[model samples]
Target: MITVDEIKRMLPHRYPMLLVDRVTELVPGERASGLKAVTCNEPWYEGMPDTATEEDYHYPWTVLIESWCHVAGVLVTWDRPNPDVRSGKAMLLGGIADAEFHRPVVPGDVVEHHVRLARQVGETYVFEGESLVGKETALTIGRLTMTMRPASDLTAPPVPDPL
Candidate 1:
């Protein structure tokens, strides 16, 4: 199991943005399974009014996908750890497709994300998986791609297009 502190070292994400709680299973460069528990005390829930219902506390899809991707990041960085994305190489999302949300994930729902490497081409890796809450699958990822590129390259001035 990869603890939160260990995950912090493998991933650049932090509080509020760091949604992955713990990784229960990991096979470097192959596959991984992680968990994230949604609580009512999260920052997003702070803005909820007293009149809010259960649906009002539903977890955001963006956060869900990001948390799952963090697990994928761990698999990618297990051997070559890059704690800082500002330098070294950074993992960037190339694509995410066919994300089917089966049901709403609400507060108290512990999401179990199962992700595996679908393919690897050069510095890019494709992942496909699904997330579940107990027996119900919440989201099915048809394909998710991540590419590693130097941070400097990303921030460097773009080349001018000569017409």
Candidate 2:
């Protein structure tokens, strides 16, 4: 088991963005399971209109996906110190596929993400997972890919005109 403080060390996310609260299970380079508590105090809830409909009040799907990715991040980096913190490298979201949101997540919900390593190529890792609220699945990710590289490489030079 890993505490929130330890998870903070493994992931670059913080405050409202740090979705994973604790890791209950981890198998280095294999799989991981983590939890996140959804609360009305989150930044996303700020300025929400009092008259907003149920659809408008749903938790952002992107953040839910990111929470799952954070769990996968722990699984991928389990064998080494966090590259984002230790070496100033950046861990990035490369791609996501077949991501389906099944139910709306409310403020009082506790999301549990279960992730498995699907593949790895060089510094890129692919994961398959699902996010659940109790026994009900909230979302299913068919494939999610992440890549780690020097932060300096993130800047784009320029695009030339087609000849």
Candidate 3:
């Protein structure tokens, strides 16, 4: 089991963006399971109007996907010592394919992310997993790929003025 503090040390995320709360199970290069407690106090829920519809109030799918990716990040870097702690490198989400959302996730949900490392080729890691709320699968990810590289490599060049 890994505490939130330990998770913080391993991941680059912070408040509001740091999704994974605890890691209950992990196997260095094979698989992992993590938990994320969603609450109404989240930043995404701050401005939600009382008159909002269920669709409008539902937790964003993008954030849900990110939460899963964060867990995958921890699993991939498990064997390394403080892999993301102030390191100039970062794990980038290369791509996501075949994602399907089956149920809506709300504030009171405790999301359980289960991930399995399918394979690794060079610096790229491929993963397959699902996010569950209780016994129901909330989301299924058929393929999620991540690549580790220097953070500087992702910096975009300044845009030129309009012609």
Candidate with the greatest TM-score versus the true structure: 1
RMSD of each: 4.0, 4.5, 5.6
Across residues 1-163, which tens digit of lDDT does each residue of candidate 3 receive? 9888888777777887889999989988899999999888989988888998878767899999999998998897666634453454677777788899999999889999999999888778889999999999999999988877766666753222111
Displacement of the residue 34 alpha carbon in candidate 1, Å: 0.5
All candidates: TM-score? 0.91, 0.89, 0.89
**What TM-score, to 2 decimals, does candidate 3 have?**
0.89
lDDT of 2 at 117: 89
lDDT of 3: 0.83
lDDT of 2 at 156: 54
CA lDDT of each prediction against the hidden true structure? 0.85, 0.82, 0.83
lDDT winner among the candidates?
1
lDDT of 1 by residue, 4-57 (tens): 889878887778888889999998778999999988898878879899988788
Worst 10 residues of 2 by lDDT: 154-163
Please provide, for model 2 over 1-163, each residue's C-alpha lDDT reduced to its tens digit, 9 standing for 90 to 100: 8988887777776776788888999987788999999988889989988998877768899989988888988887666657364466567887788999998898889999999988887788888989999999999999887887666777852222111
Clashes of each: 0, 0, 0
